[model samples]
Every structure is written in structure tokens, then in C-alpha cells.
Target: MFFAVALLLPAMAAADPLVGVWKTEPDRKNLISHIKITACGDKFCGKILSAYDATGKEVQTPNIGKKLFWDVSSEGSGKYGGGEFWVPLIDVDAVPQMTLQGDTLKVKGCEHVLCAHQTWSRLQS
Candidate 1:
């Protein structure tokens, strides 16, 4: 029983869409951060590849080299739970409930009841 279940785990976990670089809507002035996502253990994590300030100048932030998700184990079926997301735009932290749909990664959460949703596209390898 253990062996069978273990064999299935990898296949299921590998389906997450948050496994590549995601370019934000460049036309939308409000979105200017490009994210590159990869796997850490059984969880998915992302980092800011290009961060632009309001004036469109690249600025360095502490979280730039940080792990966006740590100890975030997979839940199942292209869904991941129990992960924290740090958005550079808001400069705040929030718990993320992320789902992988096709080539899109959807994340929704709130910071102190102020909710926000972000959709990221998967970059081609």
C-alpha cells in the first residue's frame, strides 16, 4: 500500500502550473513585477526576476533573493495550501491559496481582510 501511494504522489504533485517564469501584464502600469517559479522539495516557490518601482526604475528589495514559499507541501489535484506569499508591490505578507489551471496559476488571499487575486502565466522552457 505504501509503495503504491508513493508512486502516485510524484505524478500528482508535478501537475502544478506554478513551475515556470511568469511575465505580468506589461501593458498594465499597475503590474510590473515578473516572477520566476520553481519547485522546492514538494512545494512551489517564486522569486522576482525584475522589479520596477512606480517611476519604472529597478530597485533592490530585501525579499528579492528570498524564498517566497517555504515548507509549502502539496495538497493535491493541482491545488496547494498552507503557503505564504510576499508581494513586493504591497510590501506585505499574506497567506496564499493557489491553484494550477492549465498554464495559469491563480492565487487569492487577503491581508487583514483586504483581499486580492493574481493570475500568473507560465513561461515556456
Candidate 2:
């Protein structure tokens, strides 16, 4: 039973187009983070996997393992919408729309009329 379940896990994850670890572009402070997207109930969620500072050194942070993306629903093709995104900096939640293209994932989150955009690259496993 254990062997069957273990083999099925990878196949399930691979069935979802967005299920994988993704690396974010360097922030203004040159910090980068990896986010692991996975199935969350019937939707999708993402949590921080790792973080790196300006010197490209791995660092421990409070945001590690925290859910940064939640309740994201597929809108067909590579587009996803209706997700609640968390911003660790100001601790605010925003609604976001995401689109995936090849190895790149583009996200746009909006809080009221203010919108922020981020492009993330897929991390090779």
C-alpha cells in the first residue's frame, strides 16, 4: 500500500501544470524566494520553500513555509484566477490572477485599485 501511494503522489503532482517549485525574481533588496505550489483541497496553494539574501546565501525567515498563495482556481489553458495572495512585507492580502507560459509564471495581485506584478521562473527539480 505504501509503495502504491508513494508512486501515485508524483503522478498526481505532475498532472497539475502549476505543481512545482518556482523561483521568484530578486526583490529590491536582492532577496529571492522559492515557492512550492501544490493542491489545496479543490484549489491550489503555494508556500515558501526557501529564501536567499542579496549575497545569494540561504537564510531563515518567518515567512518560510507560510502560505503565500491560496484558493487559486484554474481558468483554463494556463490562466488562473480568484486567488488570495499574502504579502509578507506589509502582511496584507490581495486578489491575484496568474498565467503560466512555459517555465515562467506571471502574477498580478490587486488591493483595491493598487496592483503589483511578479514574474517567477520554474525551478528545475
Candidate 3:
């Protein structure tokens, strides 16, 4: 049983091209974060793996292991939706939509009339 599960794990993960680490663009504060997207149940989820300053120095924070978004499913054509984005600093949640384009992932969040967008690049192992 263990051997079977181990052999299938890699294949399952490989089935989804979005399952990998992504380097987010720098925010207003010049802070960049690495987000790891993985399969959760039958959907997709992402969490913060690490963070860095503008100079590429890793920074430690309380939200390092926190979930960035969850319950995302593919919407076909490399697009995904149906997820909520959590912002720890503001204590708010936003609906998220994502589009995967080659090595770039376009992530957008919206709450009421306000919306924000970011382009994240795939992190090569």
C-alpha cells in the first residue's frame, strides 16, 4: 500500500501544471513572497512558503506558513476561480481569480468595488 501510494503521488502532482512554487511580484513595500500551490482534496490551494526583501534577502514573519488562498478549481483555458484570498494585515477576504500563462500566473483579488492584481512567476527548482 505504501509503495503504491508513493508511486502515485508524483504522478498525481505532475498531472496539474499549477502545482509548484511561484515567486510573487514585489508589493508596495518592496516585499516579495514565494507561494506554493498544491492540490487540496479535488481543488487547489496556496500558502506562503517564504518571503524576501527587495534585495533578495529572506525575511521571517508570523504569516510565513499561512494560507494565501483555497478552494480554487480550474475554469478551463488555464484560468481558475472560486476561491477566497486572506489578507492577514487587513483582516479581510477577497474573491480570487487566476490565469496561468506559461510560466506566469496572473492573480487577481476583489472585494466590492476594490480590486488588486499581481503577476507571479514560476519558481524553477
Candidate that scores best on TM-score = 3
Tens-digit lDDT track of model 2 for 1-125: 98888777556645678888999988765789999998775578899999999888999988898999898887879998897999787779999899999999998888999888889999953
The sequence of per-residue lDDT tens digits that candidate 3 reaches over residues 6-125 is 777556645787889999998777889999998885578899999999899999988799999998887878998988998655768999999999999999988898888999999962
Provide the lowest-lDDT 10-residue window in model 3: 6-15
Residue 37 lDDT, candidate 1, scale 0-100: 71
Local distance difference test, each candidate: 0.66, 0.86, 0.87
Error of 1 at 17 (Å): 4.1
Instruction: In candidate 3, list every pair of residues with a backbone clash.
Output: none
| Model 3 alpha-carbon miss at residue 30, Å | 1.0
My TM-score estimates for the predictions, one after another, are: 0.66, 0.85, 0.86
Instruction: Give candidate 2 regions above 4 Å deviation.
Output: 1-14
Compose the digit string of candidate 1's lDDT tens values, residues 1-125.
99888776655545555567775544234535667776665566777777566667876656566655544556878787677877555668778777878888787766778867877777653
TM-score for model 3? 0.86
